[model samples]
Target: MAANFGELFLTILLIVCLTVSSQGREMMEKKYPYLRLASSFSSAKARGYDYIIVGGGTAGCPLAATLSEKYRVLVLERGGSPHGNLNVSYLQNFHISLADTSPKSPSQAFISTDGVINARARVLGGGTCINAGFYSRASPSFVMAKGWNLELVNESYPWVEKQIVQFPELAPWQVALKNGLLEAGVSPFNGYTFDHIYGTKIGGTIFDKNGFRHTAADLLAAGNPKNLRVLLHATVQKIIFNTRSPRPYAVGVLFKDENGRRHKAFLHAGRHSEIILSSGAIGSPQLLLLSGIGPKQDLQRLRVPLVVNNEFVGKGMSDNPMNTIFIPTKGHVEQSLIQSVGITKMGSFIEASNGFGQSSDSIHWHHGISSAEIGQLSTIPPKLRTLEAAQRYAKTKHEIPREAFQGGFILEKIDGPLSRGHLQLINTDIDTNPNITFNYFKHPRDLRRCVYGIRTIEKIINTNQFSNLAEDDSYTINMLLNMSVKANVNFIPKHTNDTVSLEQFCRDTVITIWHYHGGCHVGKVVDRDYRVLGASRLRVVDGSTFATSPGTNPQATVMMMGRYMGLKMLRERLGRRAGV
Candidate 1:
């Protein structure tokens, strides 16, 4: 397996190097002059920064760029730069990146307490570097519900779209998926749109026509290079607080570099200066808890110094549950990621992908077996599965030569799952994943939505558009769906029976679309302006603050929110300076 990866890595590297012209290489360097290694980050400049943004991710990158337009901004990313990483930069290597179990891999794999295997972005671009690259704006209702200035939200979307989003030319498999969706009565076809309309539509992708992925890290090119300083491989251990004042507030952050050298980055004394946490859903809350701002009992048990004691810090956690079925095709299907989507009013989103597999030399290590290769493990029966077994099973699912094996997946994912969970710290290590559970199907409504979504997928399979790709008429696509939804509850904790019902299948087969949001939510943890309720000069501006996952994919809105909120903050600062 190691030998296989080495050859694959070399080939991918050669491809990436050839694809990037000299002019392109020069442009990238010039575009991000301020980006540097954490070792080069000088502590002398700590107090000079106007804002210290943790996590140079989907929200953090744009936020730093926008703020750097006027202020001295610092972005500390725990991961390395995404500039030349073949796994992060190429569309075909998506699953390979996630399958990489190395400590420095761009995708950080983790299992939810609900027994679902998931991943978090460990690269500068965050999830944008590791995601399916689907791009679409949030629904108007989503904007309205968040009480955002709809005009500003509208303006912010274009700012992000212009930089990274692109209209994807549909692959043959994508066209088939679109036709099948429409044939299944999803709705009026909305072709080549970024709007989140309830219909079959072709959405934007971050991967350009050349199949090179453009991540949020690219947004840093928009920053004022002289004012913005990006520090890579800087893991922020905790937020330093100033308790001397009547109101406790953040003063700086204590972070460590790759070499384990600790450093402190302090904010300028400016009244509007702040420490923003764009460390993502799992990250933001975990940081807060580590910093002694979460439930008092948890903090006390952990023996951390309490700062504000906000119990809701890690509350309201939710993940969109997805159920998928494999569709093996006899003929060739071109490889593609998410492009076509069907947004049903029934609170589910339908999507598909095809023709992703590894070469014969590395078939044993191929990671494209699980659905769209999102690398899920919950699909395996819990009682018989370990992480290694699940991963090994996923990788070696295809025994035939790569060319001989061909298939795709049709997936249905429930939206805005009402089922919620919480996150708790296991230890103080900043790099350690906090214990989290989505409590999938805890609410009966979530199960019903899953059933509805799965049934819609059945309708799509039954359509002639999809039948064209199937191996034969005898193939039963809905075999799993036909199973019962009820049985005596005899399973052990987190384990289920082999002949599970559809409802049990929804629970048993549940996996993350990696769109999990809410560990710190709006109103409960942060205000309308995204300011932490009980803390000063601290705010979380990422998916962690979302009450509901936006649209089909939240990256667009996440990027938009970063820009929108940064503009708002800049205006506020300018207003205060002008004595407004």
Candidate 2:
């Protein structure tokens, strides 16, 4: 696995196109002068640090910076560049930020191991570097529902806003998006707004004063303490344990360089090291599995020793259903500035145009109902399911007129019918990317709801308000209607007129976000206190540690978790929050 990854990221040069810059080379060279060629892994094998967090992403970034004020901290992100090369700052710049083919929303745009490709940033700040900068207010009740005191979290949020996630002003963008929809009769209001305080149609992202992407990496750049050191393009491959006692204790991490060369980072738990896995949901789980801390059968099959036999190790994996709706706007909206959530445009209905050819970052508007079936715990869906779905959608026949593409179109894909997937180690090497397969849209009803989502969008768009955009010529609507009837025959997606079955559309746009969860859930790996259930010296703090599924976004949630866990760590370390 180590050897494979070394070759994989050797070039380390992303071949994406952000804008029509005549000279991208000059731009890259000027911006990321610290870029490294694929070389042997450089090692930092010191025997001590106060805290050593693996997978420095959403959670890790904040935790590392904050904790470093009082303790020595080390952050290891498996991907490249910590400061976030200018290219990775904005998502629309994805063409330049990530060269990987896996699209963020739809499954049709990828091949095997494509789920990983759908994600971004192996750099210092993790997903924040590649995310579409949408900030959600923490759901107070939701946090309280998890048995946590929402007050403490609530208290921390404003401080977090000032220092970390800069929730943006959205009225202008909202007004712009909504006013157009209203003029066209597609929306009730002049712009979008949120109902719930936290759920207020989502606000935009935290861009810097100068308008560059404000990522965790950027936050780290400004206020981070000198003690927090970030190791980029580095992967932590193993947890070396002190097995002198019955309960094994973690002592150090084994890492591999880009050349596949192995090195041991000696972290003495008390004097120098406390390990935290902040690699978001996917990366954290894979790190554990690779470290001999997963299911017995998987360990046996892989010829790896089993140090801990936790049945729910990689189970309960989850992510939100992200359905997309693309509406042709009256004017251009900032393609990159993120207005995360907006209400259903008044009369603007959603229609699943399960078409094959389209870009992924188009609008992701509208939510779908999630239906879950807890099949036998062993009935997890395989990678093959997604592959088959993609194949089926790709080989379709359709001829919808161009006029139909003028308005908004919904691409409903994922929802809670969680036929889950798991993380397994290909080998015991930190350099390897996990073998991840999001068995997306595994439930038939889940598929139906996705199609329904699109239909809803179409209905909203065709509202009386949008009558202005409707074609007066019966020829266009009739042609579109005939095409819809024919298109609905075999699979879901695009059908003509306002009268197509959503069931068919479900068969069209099913995809995954590659953000799987539940590998080290509270009940399994960690107890209610977040201490690794059976071990005293080990703990998990990333998204992998989430106990149950939260219905909305998880980036800020992940960061909050890190802050929570860090506070706990701070208390424990000092013997209280202002601990000794």
Candidate 3:
């Protein structure tokens, strides 16, 4: 009887302990629901989701979270999670991620065929994981031009801001940048607002008070965990379509796991099931072309099976062109990213950052000069080539040593570029990077705008507030501009005011601001509702859907679009259920 009682008591105690522990686990799960991995989940087929979102990125993360509120949503990310990545978590390590070329690194660095070096995030948080965490709302003009519902856009902005956006604790360098911008006549300080006003304004950032970055992945905390499944390192290869129906419907997607094992997740046969491609500007269009949804001729050339004959899928690509002016300081400047922006009336935007430690590896002398330009210069007098090569070598040799603390301002042409580019597949293989040509400065106006942008930066640096920080007593505004211009051989000139020389300089020195957009633009590739034209239940919700690039850093606009689309889809689903 004693032994029986002891055993019974022990069993009862074990049950009680488990009950408490289980409750604890439930609480933890709710707190960090995004910690769950795709590998831990059951087979995709067994857990059919109402929505399967490809590219667990800036748009995809928020869209999944919003949809999961009432529907089962699965997010398939091509890269690993950003939850614990120090390179992603810390504000100072911003450029380290951009320069990282590792296969597993969240930032995937790629050089364009046009000889421009840039990066895009492969991690779950998308570009938000690797980019300088500047945040701002889309210009009201941009919203109205795109025909988006203004009220819905306004409502969606707070949904993202409440979770991740914060006003930056401006570092000393950022303060100087702001004062300099105001002094340079980029006036009307709007002060601490997310609105994209045309003036010097202190905007929002994803970095918090502790100097840690809060990414789009953090927005996942708002999701219904029981209904959401996030898969990391899950690269989607193709969109599976049901052609048996009169109109081809995106029924499922075939993706590869981290181990390279293939898996497919299909939509549940519910009233409204969808597969959204928020895979960014490049990835979204690339995936579509691979799935036989692009121009008929291009697909036929690659021998890909025809699914849709959309000629506009991989066209109309645009990226903001950046011209950087490096003002290397002798004193230690506090490390900072974009905080204050100078919006010029001349259709350019100037932004500054400090602590770019060795991140300019992508913008070296040898690599800066395009092969075409090099060839064009090969026939020139060896004297000019030697002088050019020597100048380039000298700049790198000087800058490389100071990369650890050397910080400067970047001036970007946010507007005035009329030229557009295209992205085409090298083959049907998903692993191969697409052929992207921005055709930057193909238009004369773009060159003029770039020159104007450079002149604007010259003015800013000449500001008494900014010039006081400069180390060289002899460094004049023209000298600094000339130094920047000489970085690219094609831009080198006999004199500063030579319009032809400056125009050539603009052509050669232009690089992407990493704000690539369009290719799957509204009215061309997708409709205003974000549904792919001529395809059912297929949609794109990333920057690719933008008719044109927003006049600011596009992170906020991208997130708002995700929130807007997710809510729209939900309303549609509810409406369908009610037989409305």
Predict model 1's lDDT versus the native.
0.82
Worst 10 residues of 3 by lDDT: 365-374
> In angstroms, how far off is 380's CA in candidate 1?
1.3
lDDT, model 3 = 0.75
Can you give the lDDT of residue 6 in candidate 3?
A: 100
Kindly give the stretch of ten consecutive residues in candidate 1 with the minimal lDDT sum.
Answer: 483-492
Residue lDDT tens for model 3, 1-580: 9999999999999999999968865664677775444554456345667999999899998898989888888898889878767878987566566645679989775555565666778898898888778998878788888787787788899999998998999987789888988888889999998988888999999999887999998888888888888888888999999988889989889888777788778887763788999999999999999987989998999899899899999898887777655555657677677888988777788887655332233532222112111121221222243434534544454443332234454455657367788999998777677988777777777777777777777777778887678667665656544544443322223344777766665665666668888889888899878889888988889998775677578899888888888887887768646321
lDDT tens digits, residue span 219-265, model 1: 98898898999998899999999998888899899999988999999
Give the TM-score of each candidate.
Answer: 0.88, 0.71, 0.84
List per-prediction Cα lDDT, in the order shown.
0.82, 0.50, 0.75
Count backbone overlaps in model 2: 41
User: What is candidate 2's lDDT per residue for 358-449, written digit by digit as tens?
Assistant: 23554321111110000000011223335444344335422433433333333333423455666656676544555655555555555555
Q: Rank order by TM-score, top first?
A: 1, 3, 2
RMSD in order of candidates: 6.7, 9.2, 9.0
TM-score (C-alpha) between model 3 and the true structure: 0.84
